[model samples]
Target: MKQISSSQLNREIIDLIQNHPEIDDFEVLAIDLSGHFYGKRYPIASLKSFASEGLAFPRSAIVVNTLGEPLEGIYYGEGDGDPDAQFSLIPGTLSVNDWGNKPRAQIMATASSGKEATFFEPRNLLKKVLQAYQTKGWHPTVAFELEFFLFSRKRDDQGLIQIVRNPKTGRPDSPTLLSNTRISDFERVIDNIIEACNQQNIETGAVSAEMGAGQFEINFNHHSDVMRAADETCLFKRTVIETAKKHGMMATFMAKPLLDQPGNGMHMHISVLDDKGENIFNAGNKPQQRLLHAIGGLLDTMPAAMSFWAPNINSYRRYSGGSSCSPVSLSWGHENRTVAFRIPLAKDGAWRVENRVPGADANPYLAMAVSLAGMLHGMNHRLDPGKPCDGSVENGDEYLPLSLSSALAISMGSEVLIDILGRDFIELYCQHRKADKVAFEQFINAREYDWYL
Candidate 1:
């Protein structure tokens, strides 16, 4: 779908509230560095105020690192710092926040200036990359398969810690079968999540209980525009988390929680269509092999792309050698989860490549943008990826980063990433992530390693 303008967005919001009187307040949300939702809630009557003058938020909101530290002079205060950015609501995303006790409608917002200039907002970043595909007369479709875990808040005789445990099982949980096989405990949480998604017009291809005890996966319908797909993902995660809280449970997108259990993954399936809306990846005589080169680009840049895939320190724990779903190297095979990339063997339209590198903790917009950037680089250079791996991709030498520090270094050193994402954005991102890594290191003392894991 095409991007709607400010006036169109206003009309859509007004019509929505008018039709559904149940919505009393409108919540405008922005995604933060930690993948947390941050925004303000306004009464439905004040919708006109936002539509006319646009909602104003402090410049400092986007400047801070994940730990909320200001980066000194980089603040770029108002006329100099980050200007109070404007956030106009997205048309289709208007809905009530499921977790809120009061009646409220939620809308996704983008950072914009008075002159209609868009800044380096996370969502806008992906929009620019999608526009690049449009410039080349190509349309890209993407579907994300997201996996996460459920946990009950943990408490000791002393107090509560961030570490949680599965409610059904008393001890640290595993993915195997348990005493509670009825799935009744999670029924309300799942139902609320599905209902919230429906309210936001987010489409779900399927939802299933995963291998882990509280682990679950939700597959979204493919979208022709990458921005829409990312937006839907961001909204979906928020909905799931909020709904879970209502049921007195915690939902974590953390990549890996328990050592031996399966880590949560965000597997992205991508395909490109030409001007005629036909699958470009499927038209060739040897489509699977041709797609290999695209896979090559992904594998070639994966080390550097790790910053986007595993943004947090805890994220790297997901890349274990023996995990069936974890990819150890830059390799692709038909329907093989052992490799970094998998070409699902299916019909014409269903033909797509699944990049399994990213953790569930990744930022959807950045992950998708970096991935598209890699594919574009490959398509432009006409790079050949050689051959797909046969059985396993576990070459010790070719393995991805085992920690966040190594991943950050790879991202900073990537020339291809610099060329595509632009030097300024790369530098900014690196600085932010570095600060996060340092803070995390300090927060967890040498004796606390086991506690976090």
Candidate 2:
């Protein structure tokens, strides 16, 4: 029940222990720029000491790239000698993990030496962007629709992933589009996932089988707290993956797990509430200037924000095709899935824009940061997005970044993004992406020699 935002660590720790005695241990988690949560577990009794001093983690934590390799040219590496940074909890994130091996509480954290937050931390970057909206008295409501693939534990002869079979009829893999039969076939898996999500208090709205075989999409309920929405996304991924393993299958959030099959995506839906708690996006079917400005902002910064949306080399493949609604161009439309931004057809008071750009593999914190920043920036500058498109936009606008290298180049050089996400975080994120690009390029894939050799 207690929340610690400042120096009330001791008092808050006491209150936490008194309130949540069911939890024996605590998982101190901190999300870095690479979207990786790295930290250790401590006994609940040790919260008094650890909470005050803050659990220590290396500064290199933020510099880690997608490949898990440390990206150089950062201030913490050579000059600062990779010193330890203090990590403190985000207060109310403490929750009992129903899916864990034992009774344990988990909390989100940020690492910094001073009272100010570290810009390189993904959560901090998001917080910084959200502050802009807060300053204008514009509250943001957000939700996420995550698509993932479930594969059997066993791999093929060549170690390729195969979809989990439907036990009843013994169907290997059928692209059953929204069939209730498919839901019953995977009832146990779906039920267990629901149980796990319920334990964490994650409000899930809908669960349905997607276009691909054994692929499913889960939708979270819309909420006013943007940070909590992002937190649920990270926790939902961990919950789904762990629960899948328990059910004798593996769940992957990879953008493109298969070359021929559909890729996974994380779609974000957003709307702003005014001071009177009214949806600003509810300005008729075409929407008001505020909604349009938000669209303009997202479209304007999307090219630079591509790296954050599609963080890995394999992430780029999601846009290449095969997926039903994966967007490839930088176009916005009214309820059109072919474009990056979509104003979904909704009833009155439910109006919103869906950012269909981010892949399932993206760091939720960073992706939300860039998306929000673009909107806030657009509103500030009153950027006009022009008219909306009605077409599917196979190749309407300019081409988006096709590789991590190109995405990194544009992200690093984007003054608007740099201003929103901060120069320190932008520079740091791009460096890590650049390192990952070089590493991926150096290692030639086996398929390369299939034709050449």
Q: Which structure among the candidates has the greatest lDDT?
A: 2
Q: Which candidate gets the maximum TM-score versus the true structure?
A: 2
How would you encode candidate 1's per-residue C-alpha lDDT over 50-146 as one tens digit per residue?
Answer: 7666687765566466655665434334236466666666656666565787657778776763333344467766776777778988788999989
Q: Positional deviation of 404 in candidate 1, in angstroms?
A: 2.1
TM-score of model 2 vs. true structure: 0.91
Mark the regions of model 2 whose C-alpha exceeds 4 Å error after superposition.
1-23, 72-75, 98-100, 112-117, 284-286
Clash totals, every prediction: 8, 0
* Quality of model 2 by C-alpha lDDT: 0.80
Q: Write the per-residue lDDT of candidate 2 for residues 1-453, one digit (tens) a residue.
A: 334364565555676678777778888877766666677888787776666556778867767766556665556555677777777766556666756677677777776534443657777777877788878888999998999999988999878898788857776758787888888888888888887778677888888888898898889999899889998898898888988888888898999998778889999999999889988778765577887898898988988999999998899888876756788777888878888899888787578889999999999988988998898878788889887789767663455787788888889989999887778778867877777666667776679889788
Full-model lDDT, candidate 1: 0.73
